[model samples]
Target: MELLRSLAAALAVGVLIGIERGWRQREAADGSRVSGLRTFGLLGLAGGLASHMPESLAAVIGLAVTASLVLGYRSEQARTASLSITNTLVGIITFALGYMAGQGLVSETLAVAAVTTLILTLRQQSHAMLKGMSHKEVESIATVDYR
Candidate 1:
């Protein structure tokens, strides 16, 4: 019953982030290296489940999964141009924290998760503006003769 509740909380957190990503069309069509809201939420639940195991084992598994997600995103970004994995990872961690909150481990997990979500959500606009600036710079340079 507790596990179910934890899972539900995790899924809710995941879905919240997922809805945003899906609405923004942040995922790739090929689905190769992308980790959207659902993936992140599931990963968090899995991490929570793993936490039930021995502490050392849980820590190792969590770190391994987090590292893999990061590396996978880096590789995917190099191969194809799209949203970075940092925000996705943040979502995953947020979901995990939500699960922890559901399990009664921490009192402020929801607040922390909300803040993290906000940070991730805002990143899109900052990145887009940066890209736009780069584009403007390139265009301006193109118009100026080097010779």
Candidate 2:
């Protein structure tokens, strides 16, 4: 079925991102992460299912997902005292990617997922490159408005 395919694509997106996240946090304790492979997969599926609903209902589901992600981040922040929000941001993005899959843009969705996963995988390389760059260069990059 079409819905099944979309959900499967969504799961694939989540699993792709989740692989990176899981590997990144491999050194951390077993269950301390805000989200890892399983949670992201479920979130992806949830997004796909939500997308099948009415517009207003989908919006409500999105809100619930956002709220849950924020709360999970908050809890993990309290435990780890980590100010970094990269994982939370990625989780949110994974949801959006799922929504894209649900929209039947399978090829485009996979492309975006690949790009996002590449970015996620390049964190260390990105930071290392920044070390050689001047402040203005970094500032310009940081301040550039894509909009």
Candidate 3:
């Protein structure tokens, strides 16, 4: 059925993203990371499942997931003394993509997932680029882009 296809798409997206996340976090000490392959996969599945429900139900589920991610972020920060919200944002995105896939927007979901995976996988390069950039240069670019 269509629902099965959606769920499959969601699962594939989760696993695809998870491969990158898991690879990045593989060296981290266990229990330090907020999420890895399994958690992301479940989040995607949850989103897909909720997508078939009423709009209010889906909204509530999304809000609840957001709150949970926020709490997880706080917990991670407390443990590590420093943490980025990138994982939390990815979680939200994964969920949304799953919902989109469930709604039969499979191509768009796959495209976004590919872009998200690329971003997540390029953390080191991204950080290096940011670190190498001067504040003035960043400001200039931002000002020009905004204008």
lDDT of each: 0.64, 0.86, 0.87
Q: Tens digit of lDDT per residue, candidate 3, span 20-107?
A: 8888889988876568888888778878888999999999999999999889988888888876888889989989888988898888
State the lDDT of candidate 1 residue by residue for 1-147, as single tens digits: 776666666566666666555555555465652656677666666655665668787678767777777777767777877675665466557546754755655436556666666766787697887677877787887799877
lDDT of 2 by residue, 35-134 (tens): 7788788777777887898989989988988898899888888887889888888888888889889999889989998999999889889999978899
For candidate 1, list the clashing residue pairs, or say none.
none
Q: Cα miss at 24, model 1 (Å)? A: 3.1
Task: For residue 122, give model 2's deviation from the true position in Å.
Answer: 0.4
Off by over 4 Å in 1: 30-33, 81-85, 95-99, 124-147
Worst 10 residues of 2 by lDDT: 28-37
Which rank order by lDDT, best down to worst? Answer: 3, 2, 1
Q: Native-vs-model 2 lDDT?
A: 0.86
Worst 10 residues of 3 by lDDT: 138-147
Q: Which is better, 2 or 3, measured by lDDT?
A: 3
lDDT of 2 at 14: 90
Best by lDDT: 3
